[model samples]
Target chain A: DTAVSQTPKYLVTQMGNDKSIKCEQNLGHDTMYWYKQDSKKFLKIMFSYNNKELIINETVPNRFSPKSPDKAHLNLHINSLELGDSAVYFCASSQDLDGADTQYFGPGTRLTVL
Target chain B: DQQVKQNSPSLSVQEGRISILNCDYTNSMFDYFLWYKKYPAEGPTFLISISSIKDKNEDGRFTVFLNKSAKHLSLHIVPSQPGDSAVYFCAASGFFQGAQKLVFGQGTRLTINP
Candidate 1:
């Protein structure tokens, strides 16, 4: 079974369009995170939810929002996407928020905003 | 500011040779460090990790070394195979805003030549 899975592996949308990417983890983890990797391969944490509670929120723009319906799922929604939003979005999950815990990542969703 | 930095953008190594990737961090509070490997069109997978209290940790052909005094870490893959070619990312986690969040460095592309 895929430990982590993401929907719409590839997404291409125009500017000002809104889209949502869904993520699911079968690892039964409690902490889920969203990350963004840019063209230069610089990975940055966008948001994190532990047991459906927001734990970490990086300085991302307001247009980007994360929703965790449950411990096993987390979804990212973008509003009025801009060119800068074109990047790969990754969903990751860990057993908990322990700093030493290992995080399992799903196949990334490549988002292109033209 | 990039707290964690991987100065080398790319490293080429012959198959069956040792591949070493280096990372440096400016945050003294970072207590847990991890290495992740990512292939084309996939999210990063956790490779190895080391805590601040330990100087080294090894798993099979992969090993991680941490030097707290220098705030530096390195991942060594011995007998690297062609399949090992991918982007390696170094990440660190510490208490931030009442929770632990990971900070990833710019990835290093490792090419294992057969």
Candidate 2:
């Protein structure tokens, strides 16, 4: 079975629009994270949640928000998407925040803002 | 400024040859180092990792070496195959994970020619 999966593999929207990307995992992991991969192929952590509680909130804009209804699901919502938000968004899960715990990632969602 | 850097944007290697990828970081607090592999249109998958206490760790054909003094790391793959063609990302984490974050390099695309 796929460990992690994300919906709307390809999202095309206009600037100032609202959009949401849904992520789910069945690996029984305790932590989930959202990452942004820019055009330069640099992946940066935007947010992290452990057991449905927000843990890591990097220097992301307030327009972006992460919500985890349960340990298996973490969704990303953008209040007003901008052209700069066009990038590949990835969802990941780990057993814990421990160094030994490796993360399992999804196929990723490519968001394009026009 | 980028804390983690992968100087080489891409590398080409022949099948059955050895492929070496390098990574450097500017942070001294990073104790856990990891490598992930990714294909186009997909998220990165965890490959291997090393902790500060140890200088080297190996799994099958993959080996990771860490040099704390130089803040450098390398991933070596022996007998590289065509299936091994993908982008490799280097990542490091500082603090107790829960209290900190994981910094990632841009990525190095490796093309294995058969």
Each candidate structure's TM-score, on Cα atoms with residue i matched to residue i, is 0.97, 0.97
Give model 2's clash tally: 0
Which stretches of candidate 1 lie above 4 Å from their native place?
none
Q: List all candidate RMSDs to the true structure.
A: 0.9, 1.2
How many Å off is the CA of A112 in candidate 1? 0.7
RMSD of 1: 0.9
Worst 10 residues of 2 chain B by lDDT: B94-103
DockQ per candidate, 2 decimals: 0.91, 0.76
lDDT (C-alpha) at residue A80 in model 1: 97
Lowest summed lDDT across 10 adjacent residues in model 1 chain B is found at B93-102
Candidate 2 structure quality by residue, lDDT tens digits, A17-106: 999999999999999999999999899989999999998998799999999999999999998899999999999999988756898899
Candidate 2: residue B99 Cα off by (Å): 1.9
RMSD of 2: 1.2
In candidate 2, residue B97 scores what lDDT?
A: 48
User: What are the clashing pairs of model 2?
Assistant: none
After aligning candidate 2 to the native by TM-score, how far in Å is the CA of A20 from where it should be?
Answer: 0.3
DockQ of candidate model 1: 0.91
lDDT of 1 by residue, A18-101 (tens): 999999999989999999999988989999999999988898999988999889999999999999999999999999999998
